[model samples]
Target chain A: DAGVTQSPTHLIKTRGQQVTLRCSPKSGHDTVSWYQQALGQGPQFIFQYYEEEERQRGNFPDRFSGHQFPNYSSELNVNALLLGDSALYLCASSWDRGDEQYFGPGTRLTVT
Target chain B: QKEVEQDPGPLSVPEGAIVSLNCTYSNSAFQYFMWYRQYSRKGPELLMYTYSSGNKEDGRFTAQVDKSSKYISLFIRDSQPSDSATYLCAMRERSGSARQLTFGSGTQLTVLP
Candidate 1:
């Protein structure tokens, strides 16, 4: 079975610009969650999408948003990127709300 | 203080040596504890998981949780060079719906040949 997959292994964006990262959950998975891992730091929760709607969110601001499609793929959209937004964006998926999540390779976002 | 605290160790040890990694959390509500291993430029891969407290072992990995002390540990026996990676500790509270995980700064472990 294919594991979680993310697009654009790496990306560079300018300040005040927006970027969208894509994710395809592992086969047979239904829920997708996004996380941000800064340099030498563990990942911080961003938000989660289930049933095509946001199920839960972390301490992130409104600029961070996500969507889950019918096929269980997800997209994380960050608007008005800041230098601090430069980090590894990771996508995790689980079969259900309480299941163990599997992560993707992650997209490295650099804000220049 | 942060919810979870872990030593960011660039700890090095010879192959075939036993390695112990640990993390402490201030949140008493967290019931599920997990350890993840991440290689360079890669996302974390789950290594071990324990709920509440006690021990669970799988192959060379043994995970222990002490809810009373709010500390968790992951132990690897006869570690190999391939086991050298950043180990992250993550946990969450019991909930009916999806819950965001709180993680600690990962500890970088290197197993030298």
Candidate 2:
């Protein structure tokens, strides 16, 4: 069985540009969540998607958005990126009602 | 103050030693606790999960949660070089539908051979 997978292992974007990252949740999972981890810091929650809709969000600004497809894959889009937007973007998957979640390898976004 | 607090330790120890990592939280509503191990530049890998206050052990790793004190801990027995990684403690409220996790700064462990 395949676990959660993410595309574009690494990326480099200029300031004020936009970047899109993709994620495919683990098999048999339905919910997808996004997180941002800065160097030497723990991951901070971005948002969560369930049933193809964003269910909950964190303290991040509106520049960050996400989508969950019917197949349980997810995409995280960041607009007008700043240098602070550079970090490792992680995707986690779990059951809609289950408590535990599994994560993917993550996409490293570098806003230069 | 932040909701969760953890000592970001660059803890170094010799092989075969027991390692203990801990985190404290101010939110009493958080009912699900987790411990994740992350390698450099990698996403977190779930090591253990606990629903409520209690102790759960798996192989060389053990997790403990104390709801009254709002503290959680992860213990590694007979640590090895391969166990060296950043250990993160995460928790979330039980009532939420999305259940987004709040994480600590992570403790970096280096088990020297």
Candidate 3:
């Protein structure tokens, strides 16, 4: 079974550019969450999507937003990206709130 | 202080030796703890999880949580080189955002073959 899938394994963009990252959750899971992992750091929570709506969010700025589709896949969009936005964007999926979340190979975004 | 603090050790140990990794937290409300291992260019994979204050063992791995001391540990027995990766500690409160996880800077472990 596929654990989780993320698109554009790697991406490169300049400052002020906009980026959209994709994710497909594991089979039988409905919740999708996004995280940002900076170099030499742990993953930081961004927000979580459940039932096509954002149920919870972290300390991230308004620049980060997300959407959950009917099929449980999700997308993370970042606008007016800054140099600090460059990091590995990770997506995780679980059955419900606070369950064991499985992750996918993240999308590495580099801003120049 | 950050909610969770972990040492980023490029900890090196020989194969078949036991390895210990640990983390401390300032959030007393956190009741769930998890350990994840990530290889280069890959997302973290869950290795073990413990709830509140207790110990849980699975095969070659054991997770111990001491709520009194606000510290947690993961012990790996009979380590293998395949176990060489970055280990992250994540914890969350009971009623907070799902995985409102406070993650620690991971520790890079190398099991020499």
Candidate 4:
């Protein structure tokens, strides 16, 4: 089966702009989670979505938001981006909350 | 200090040597432990996972969790150059809809041939 798929392998944006990245979960998966990986740092959880509703959110500000579609696809939106926002954004998918998750290639965003 | 602490080593070792990677966490509430491997410019891939203070082995990879000491480790036996990558430790307090994970800075393992 195809693994989790993310769109626009790379992205570039300027400060104060908005950007949207998309992810499609692996087949037969229902839960999706987003993570941000900064240079030389481990990924930090941004949020999780289940049943098209956001189930959990991390310490990110209001500018970082997400949505899950009925088809198990997800979209991560960042508003008013900062240079610090330049990082790799990863999306993970799992069948249920208790199972291991599968991650996608991630979208590398460079905010200049 | 960070909740999870790890040495971001660009550790180098012989291809056939045994490799040990570790992480320590300050939160005793963490109940599940996992190891993830990531190649450069890629997202991390799950390697092994454990729920209790014990060892779980899969092939040449073994994950050990020591709840009492708030420590966990990943061991790679008969390591290959293919195993050269970054190893990250992750954990969660519990399971459910709120299954958010905390991650540690990855250690870069370089298995030289």
Q: Label model 3 with its docking quality class.
A: medium
- Model 3 lDDT tens row, B1-113: 88899999999999999999999999888888999999988999999978868889999999999999999999999999999999999988887556667799999999999
lDDT by residue (B12-70, candidate 4, tens digit) is 99999999999999988899888999999997899998898989999999999889999
Can you write out model 2's per-residue Cα lDDT over B1-113, one digit (the tens) per residue?
A: 88889899899999999999999999999999999999988889999999978899999999999999999999999999999999999999988799999999999999999
The C-alpha lDDT values of all candidates are 0.93, 0.95, 0.93, 0.93
Docking class of 1: high
Off by over 4 Å in 2: none
Tens-place lDDT per residue, model 1, B1-113, is: 99999999989999999999999999998988889999999999988877868999999999999999999999999999999999999998887488678899999999999
- Please state the Cα-based DockQ of model 3 relative to the true two-chain complex: 0.77
- Compose the digit string of candidate 1's lDDT tens values, residues A28-97: 9999999999999999999889899998888899999988889989999999999999999999999883
Q: In angstroms, give how far residue A94 of model 2 lies from its true place.
A: 0.6
Task: Please report the TM-score between candidate 1 and the true structure.
Answer: 0.98
**Per-prediction TM-score, please?**
0.98, 0.98, 0.97, 0.98
Q: Which prediction has the highest DockQ against the true structure?
A: 2
Supply DockQ values for each candidate: 0.84, 0.93, 0.77, 0.82
Q: What residue runs in model 3 are displaced by over 4 Å at the alpha carbon?
A: none
Residue B29, candidate 1: alpha-carbon lDDT: 87
lDDT of 2 at B79: 99
lDDT of candidate 3 over A9-51, digit per residue (tens): 9999999999999999999999998999999999999999989
